[model samples]
Target chain A: MEPQLNLVRLKTMYEKMVLIRKFEERIIELVQEQGRIPGMQILANGQEAVAVGIIESLNAEDVIVSNHRSHGHLLAKGADPKYLMAEIMGKSGGVNKGKSGTLHLAVPEVNALMTSTVVGAGPPLAAGAAFAQQYRDEPNITVVFFGDGAAAEGSVHEAMNLAALWKLPLLFVCENNCWAGAQSYSQHCSIGNIAQRGIAYDMPGEYVDGNDVEKVYDLAVSMTDYCRKGKGPALIEAKTYRMRGHGENDHQHYVDKEELVFWTKKCPIGNLKEKMLKEGLITEDELQVVETVSKAIVDEAVAFADESPFPYAEEALDDVWVK
Target chain B: MAQLSFGQAVNNALDLAMSMDESIFLAGEGIGVSIHYDPNMPSHGLLEKYGPKRVKDTPVSEAAIAGLAVGASCMGLRPVVEIMFLPFITLATDMLVNHAGKLRYLSGGKSTFPLTVRVKAGVNFAAGCQHSHNLEAWLAHSPGLKVVFPSTPEDAKGLLLSAIFDPNPVIVIEEMGLYWGKGEVPEGDYRVPIGKARIAMPGKDCTLVCYGGATVTALEAAAILSKENIFLEIIDLRSLVPLDRDCLLNSVKKTGRLVVLHDATKFGGFGAEIAAIVAEDAFKFLKAPIKRVAAPDIPVPFSPTQEKFYKPSARMVVDAVKSITG
Candidate 1:
């Protein structure tokens, strides 16, 4: 049963997750080295599996709209690392030519559409893209990656209701990292599980352990298939943890030390590495190669960003109109 | 040429544009109804002709639907969205002002949000307060938006076509007061170029710069002032941004006197920008200080008498010209 799960695909997923983890880790160092406080540095340290596993099931033709914590989803959805790294460093060679820094990133080639700064904003956009695809008679699906905090927004509920009513090929993925800024899900939301809200919209609501990459990957595959076949919109709530604060400036004194320790132990990358080794799906040497390759790629990306030139001041006036 | 009301002209423009381009779709509330609600509304027979797929009647989620239009436009579709009333556009500010207007700039010119929003503004049918706020000034303030307020039925048809085809986001501000106003519109294809002002009634003494509902007042004032040998030049500023500054400065440069007019309140109204622009650049050519004739700083009242006073009328424009040209 383990061997039938496709070792090559699983191996790729593991490597992608490693790249996301290492990419984030390196960005923090870069921000620190710059001697400036990172303004809105949101790292998806523990939420790697949710982005990687779900994105693994999507093709380049499909669309994905992400929230502020979007680097993981961008990388996992096949966004070029060099451009993304350059973008984060505010270089002209960035994906948006340095116009959008950490919060907003759009790579259209892979159908990785806009990443919004506003919470709950991406779902409506995802539904819009899905509407176009459906209208054009295309088989593409749209996935919106938002957090538990965003699910509490009226915009998200409105988007969900509209998507369901329109029967769009849309999937709403809620990465319940528990803490929205300093507030916890318990305090912010009246409902226990965010997925339960999907029931009101007459859609299937599924929850999975976000720490387990295999479970998320399997569920995403089935869900994407269901949506592709035009079964209407669906929702998936990944019970994940926020390993770090909301932004780089946050001290996270409001977070429990025990909760941090618990999530650290259940790191998605560590869990996958252990599962693969015990199942004899991958060798110890193979795992080391994944780390080495990921580090080298990240190193190249950082160097590219470092050497890239900043755009001219006059260039700001350009791209405002499409004439 | 056929005589069409402003509403019929708007309907004809949508039908013509949609027929030409399959990518152009209509999304909004109250657009697909059978009854003629607001003279020449966008819906009428559109739903029946184009079906639900093209003429999308969305739920009252302006933010989501507006975002949907922006999202769809970014991915290579032209969406002509309607916010029903101008006041409801506040609910969609996130999508309209933030995303639609900023996406192209944020993408460093790689992406374009070719989304057109139709907003019915002003008071005429006693749709007081929430339904009758003149807010084109709010939209014109955004950099990326091409805000066009067409006065006549012909201009409405031409401007709506241009707005639909523009690669950038455009706010087509339709005056509720002018929906039933009839005018001669040319047959077949024609476009009233966006960002260009039209000389509604040209004169040499003073320039009356106005748009939307205020155009009617300005024209009436021009006729009344003509009887007194004032001979005011009436310039209907069709577009707000990419403003026909050339036409305005040329007119101001010729007349040496200017009066900015609008249905919006006098305080921080769009007229202020016109006044400031003329004062800054064309001050040397001015014989008198720039004057503004606009609605008072208050909401559109319910009573017909109060509503009459709340909106700027032809009498106010004449009074303003008298004060400025004195």
Candidate 2:
């Protein structure tokens, strides 16, 4: 059944998905043109719903700890596109002062922290942030975004156990895009459903249609509300499909071509636009407006990144040690 | 003055800190339980008195425990995390190195992590390789962390209190072997600053420098040598990082001979760092080359017979001191 979502919320969700798509496309284009970014990881394919659904329901004070595939998460959480692009370009005006490249972009103003390219590293950090929130008696929830592959990691289970046992206000969003690099979910994880692992910790867990943006948003909103009300931790497994390869260089030879074609048909953005049109929630003209605005924003970000000066050589040593 | 066990002294330090500042809380595995390892555990009665909110019991996730402590400390709370065993601390090094140690520096000094990580080190009761490890050298090599290994009950109370109040990440290595060992501890409210070494014994012929359980062994060796007319000086390095170079150099200059002792593997151990400092600063004052008495570069054997040979003993310290002063 279709989840009840307001027109305004649906549009906002569409805008966020479009922004993520365009932002990732722009990043891929830039990387193809440029030889390398010292420390960058692109999460371009299958994780838009997790980022949009959770960020839309969070307050400005709420903190997010994202995995390597965190561009969509950061952008949706209000990190400036210009600074984020500059950061990927290794410019001085970038977030983290260019010290943390793309993989480790930390925008404290937006309460977003991205970790290194190590999988399953953000849950512990999210638990820490949640602990901090509870200690300070702040009405904020800490959301951690991880991939399906991270479900197999011992650290993830450990963090889940701690969050549940301590009753910390933590929301764990698993972007189950069905692949961990070249390996499929079946090869990596024994449990068919990753969210079911939450039961071991005695926390609330749910599975959502990741392609359905409204369903994802509704679940995330409800789960976040449950956590914010001091009901402890919850986990959401957004079962989605990656329309493209894992990264820029991967051809995804391991994935069946027919399966790829099937997921492409269920592209999250296309499905959302179709739903909006069928419900008469948004006109074609409104969709066009969002596309134009998102494209313009991506173009401006590219220009800003290209024109921005590279970080000073001395800045390399500056952020190495905080005073 | 109240004389407390080493474990009780550490517990008292936490109680004092929590009483003085409401922002301080203790969190770790089995912390809320009154009878975790022993019937009369040091953390016993704390959960009932302070409530579970302050004395939290976490799952057996060292990484999460360390990360939570780091994050909580960054948000203006002093968190003391206890890892049941020192070997388990390796799981938390990522958070310790990436977040706790580098957060303040990464944020351009906008953040400060006042975290105290407590772990018990040493081979006692045959806990085997996984539990018995003297890994302070690994933490000492890191720039942003403060490493403290207190030997006596007083130093344990003082150093732990100071670590809680200090505006940095401190790793307090409590030797499990010395937990039951007693010493004089001041009654109420005392703190010993980090980076200070104390002269446990004063003599002229040779200087023996050590900390943690090795201090007791060194003192025993010093007493044995004194009966034979060999006056030995013993300096206990209460804190490893920001080491007491002045005390070490002064003692080395006066004694003209030195013997460094530590329970960790001899190669690349913290004692080697002390040897280097003396060699660089007081090389000319030395009448004999500095000697070191430490465990060989191997894991602590499980067998009692082998473990005794693996750990540096009072006889080894005495032998090293006699050889250096001869």
What's model 1's TM-score? 0.98
Considering the two chains of model 2, state its CAPRI-style docking category.
Answer: acceptable
Task: Name the candidate that leads on DockQ.
Answer: 1
Q: How well is each residue in A274-298 modelled by candidate 2, as lDDT tens digits?
A: 8879988889999999999999998
Candidate 1 on A27-94: residue-level lDDT in tens? 88877776422256889889999999899889889999988999999999899899998888778999
- Tell me the fnat of candidate 2: 0.37
Error of 2 at A290 (Å): 3.0
DockQ (0 to 1) for model 2: 0.34
Tens-place lDDT digits, model 1, residues B1-326: 99999988998999999999999899887678634555466567888899888999888899888888888998889999898889999998888888888878887777888889998887866878899888888888987888999999999999999999999899999997788778999877779999899999989999989998888888888889989999988899999987988999999999999998888888999999999989899999999888888888998898999998888888988898998777
**Pairs with steric clashes in candidate 2:** A322-B105
Which residue pairs does candidate 1 place in steric collision? B7-B40
Ten residues in a row with the worst lDDT in model 2 chain A?
A314-323
Q: What is candidate 2's lDDT per residue for B193-223, written digit by digit as tens? A: 8999999999999988999999989989988
What is the DockQ (computed on Cα atoms) for candidate 1?
0.78
